[model samples]
Target: MRKILFHLSLILLFSSCISNKRITYLQNLSDSTAIGLEEFIPFAKVDYKYILQPFDIVQIDFASSDPTLVEGFSFQRPMQQGMVGGGGGQGSDPLYMNGYSIDESGMVEIPRIGKVEIGGLTEEAAKNLVQEKINAYFKDDVYVRLRIAGIRYTTLGEFNRVGVQVIYKNRATIFDALANSGETSLLGKKNKMFLIRQYGEGTKIHQINLNDRALLGSPFYFIQPNDILYIEPMKIRQFGSADNLTASLALFGGVFASVLLIVNLVTGGI
Candidate 1:
């Protein structure tokens, strides 16, 4: 009877799949840090080349020692926040609506400056180019700051935390995505992960293997806007979904009743 009970308990434990085994596997392998465990990549320190994509909302702010000359422009675009280096002004209320939306022509209309084509320019180049445009109004030494408000990425499957994360730095690494999503479970496809990237025309799906050290240097390692990080479930979720524990419990109860009946019959034998 004890042996039978022990076997039944094992089945129940198996039904709690996708929780235990995956976590245990991940905890054993993953090391949490901004730095990678393998060889260094050039893109690691150097700023990544990023193109402004569609559906992205961006802000551009211009400030000078003399605020009087900047009266004609809208101060609503990129209000100084979350720049690469610290030491800007405090966070103030947005001066206008949520940044400028890229039109179908891939252009943003700035007051007094007209339309600027920014879809193909990297963030750094865009800042310099924008500063050139705004410099005409105020002093030549004016400051131009650019920021994006709608940058985001999503993570799903076999992860501890799975959801959309808003990106501030305009760059996110593979490790950053997983960590932000509560660290993926060990049972998840750690060695093999899927990344979905969205473009103006459509989307592209790329497969990455984390077990390989080259992954640290891969171009896909840096996540872009509208990117999806999906970690596929292991064999456990499949087996767990097939579990019919309720029926098994009923069968065990019925077996216990039958055992009681057989014992009573033998005791009553003449």
Candidate 2:
């Protein structure tokens, strides 16, 4: 009976404890504490570029050699000098109000230009297409500038803060998104998180292992608009607050004492 209890305690301790390797991000190729620059020789970094998709909001700024055309083509209302929020946090409401959204047919309606197809095109391609359209109409120096409003993403499950988060940047990495949303909880699964991305074709889920170094080179390293990052809770979460050694030991002691007290009462009654 004593041996059985001893083995049960060992099993509980081992199962509930999380190792450092599982939580650490971007592990080296050789899995060494001290890695040299030589390890990066074979690592090929992949550059991730975001392609515009349907329902994506785009910020359009128009400038022209003729100043009147600028006011005519550009529809965005100027905000008060101190109205803009700080800390890389731009509210989605303002962007949605001022920006143009791509329709299901991959078209965005520009002021006086009507609807123009831009979905599935890169930022540069979309900008050039808009430029050509404006030039054809005005036949003058009409410059068109285009940018994605911001990177808006949602986080679910085992995160410190779950829900929609907006980062105001042309490009943002996975780490940047995580940081904006307060990162994951202690019980969050670092190795097996999922990134649900929306493409022009359809939505696809990609498994992301944050602990692996190869993630830095993966195309999914960069966060795209409307991305959903989900971190599953580790099995240790089922044990509640007894995830650490001290807590587990205290839990074991409490259970053992309760069992002994019950056994003593039963014998005494008998």
Per-model TM-score, in order, reads: 0.60, 0.80
Each candidate's clash count = 6, 0
lDDT by residue (75-189, candidate 1, tens digit) is 5355545442211222432422457777767788888889888776766777777887877655545678887663467777877756666545655677776666667765576
lDDT of 2 by residue, 172-223 (tens): 8899988888878777888899999986568899999898777776788888
Model 1 residue runs over 4 Å out of place are 1-48, 75-97, 136-141, 185-187, 198-203, 211-214, 239-270
- Residue 203 in candidate 2 has what lDDT? 86
Q: How many backbone overlaps does candidate 1 show?
A: 6
